[model samples]
Target: MKKVCWPYFDPEFDSLSERIYGPTCRVCIDNESLEDCTVVKVDSLNKQGLLLEVVQVLTDMNLIISKGYISSDAGWFMDVFHVKDADGNKLADQRVINYIQQAIGTTRDPPKPKAYTTGKPLEPEPHSERTTIEMTGTDRPGLFSEISAALADLHCNVVEAHAWSHNARLACVAYISDQSTDTPIEDHHRLAAIEDRLTTVLRATTSSATAGGNCTNQQQREAKSGGGGGTMTNVERRLHQLMLSVRDFDRPLAMMEVASEEGGKASVLIESCREKGYSIVTVQCRDRPRLMFDTVCTLTDMQYVIFHASVDSHDGYAFQEYFIRHVDGCALNTEGEKERVVKCLEAAIERRVCEGVRLELSAKQRVGLLSDITRVLRENGLAVVRADVATHGGKAVNAFYVRDISGNDVDMEFVESMRREMGPIDLAVRNEKSLMPPNTADHQRPRFSISDILKSKIERFSHNFVAIK
Candidate 1:
């Protein structure tokens, strides 16, 4: 009859023990319940040949196996397996013991870490090493694309990125890697240059001449509304209309409308924009109402236009007559516009899903509260988008739109841990319509990677053997 074995180090015992020892004994001595253990070992001719060798041994022994894990630490390679022996015993065997000894003897020495040199450029790895670049400043459009283009020019690949805009400012983090290693020092120098270029780009993009031009018209309207106290309601109505128009557009666009006489109205517009996936820009109209258009321009590749109009009582029957004109033509939509919009929306939704936390702070029940939840979500690698905060009877209620979570990636244990950390919170995980699994109708044989199969088998044996103990 065939059997399975595992070799694991026990620091406390100062020796290697049969993870599965005797045919009718506990594999893990600490666990008394397990019994009927058996150990087996296999030999590999080459260090890299361990995977194939283990497969052959298992086949020869007629053992059934599943999952496994391999770890290398402290000058030793450890392979843990889960399997069942032949004779339908579902127990460990001696073959596992021999395999463990062979694996250890044949294990290769760990590779030495390479040092970065100044004169001689290092050879680039097949896969680029990931690094992050962070930018913070007054928010402006086109910032994202300008930085992306600069990285691209430097032969740097952007693997992942994130940007957030709030209170008239923006911050972003981009994961990038350099593809060329002809000169490592030169590549580092290029990164520095890119940083400098980024600063310049931000300055140019956020300048008053470029972004300021779009809000001139709104500023004038606000000034006029303030001058005519009776027209406050009319001005608010018009601003709301503009916001609705922008939101209703096929593409996402941020909107900011300011009127000095009706500051509350401006706040309402800003809140509405946030719900619609648009970054709210602050409008400060001291003399003439001015809207500061500051969003990641490159990501959206859009331009801003300011339209100013003066309405006279005689020109309009009962309301003021206003003139409308574009300050500048911003790029509207480009190639791949639909796909980009969908991706942005999907990302936004995922951020909301991952960032959501249950909150119970008051007598009344609340769904989502983001104040402390946002930080927690960020720590757990979640991005938040739309956050709704409401209060009923002195209790806070909150809901959020998030990015980067799906059922496939959800870990139940992690979710439970999060629940324990956050006091009395409810979680609503959203299903993404765009992410559907492929159909596997055909009964094609599942091709397993040699290493993967070996690992699986070892895990099966280890788990069963431990259970017996």
Candidate 2:
């Protein structure tokens, strides 16, 4: 038999994780029968955003974390969370417990060499200009919160926002639109009002060149960053933005001033490189809870493996870039395939937001019931990717991920067919109802900074769009 090296097979592997973060970690989950909840426990070396990672895992599983307790001593962290699944039932499945542990507790894979870029590309703002408001002044705690409140008072909704602080200095940039119009504020008086209120809250007491002044209409474009330069710091700020506005995932009042919000919108770009055998997709949209998870799941169900990703959320907008190849290692070599990918993504995102939940069903545990349900979906050109089916007290409660056979969204007509075929089956589906507060924190690699994102964008443009004359 051929032997394979497991991660913990050698002593050196443990040392590597200890050197970088802290120590190899262990995670576990079990059902609390009395309370009817799941208890997720984590023991890991301390790292930045560690708790956030745990929460993200629970969120991804369609589970609600009702409460948590965590403690860190020296470099080790011990945490516990009580959670419930989407159906408000206690987690009884042992497989689900293992899945949670693997998601939040597993060691990160070692980094790999990237497709190195040799020079800086002319990084341009990919979207049309909107009102960009900047503020710089004395650094103070809660500066971001105060500024956000001020903007809210003026009925301005941020599309994207970034804040950086250093050695007692703070800088912030926000692209916003008045909630009334979803367009950039055109009234000079209203713009001045917003500027004045933000300045007061930021507490730039002494008016001077370095003391910080407000700039309008220019995003931090070329503006020197005061203190933040670390890649993780920038991502932390994006996560902060996500945490702040996850439940408030509303688009600006209207479309981008320069283009339509169609599949081929200005901020949504899809390109493929045959030479590299991968596809690159860049998307700019409103940030919301579970939005990124849903997006990744859609791609996975479509049989794509993401090789690289860069995600940023600011003001009120989110920018996501994914480098991927088909699960079978095929590039999106044809224009029709590329277009289908973009259109499908757009539709999936919209459906997730509009419908609020995917498919959930409950049926009698009988011979071939699950098979017959799957056959119904298959006959209607739908495929099921992820599913949780278990019989509790003689009833089968199941959750399923359904998509189109051609990697597009399941059609509404087909959905109705599913509903009819699933008749007599108590499909206790959950529809998205109320908005919950957004919880944000993330870490993934190979992480990219703003510059890296730009260069990649330019490369895709040169490779996929440009032509030799």
Cα lDDT for residue 52, candidate 1: 30
For candidate 1, the 10 contiguous residues with the lowest summed lDDT are 287-296
What is the lDDT, from 0 to 100, of the residue 170 in candidate 1? Answer: 36
Off by over 4 Å in 1: 1-128, 181-188, 209-469
Residue 215 error for model 1, in Å? 17
Would you list the C-alpha lDDT of every candidate in the order shown?
0.32, 0.50
Q: How big is the positional error of residue 256 in model 2, measured in Å on the Cα after superposition?
A: 26
The RMSD (Cα, Å) of candidate 2 is 27.0
Cα lDDT of model 2 by residue, 45-72, tens digit? 7654455555555654556544455554
User: What digit string (tens of lDDT, one per residue) describes model 1 on residues 220-332?
Assistant: 11111011111111222232232222221222223333222212121111111322222222221111110110111112222222121121112111111111111233222
TM-score of 1: 0.22
lDDT against true structure, model 1: 0.32
Question: Which is the leading candidate under TM-score?
Answer: 2
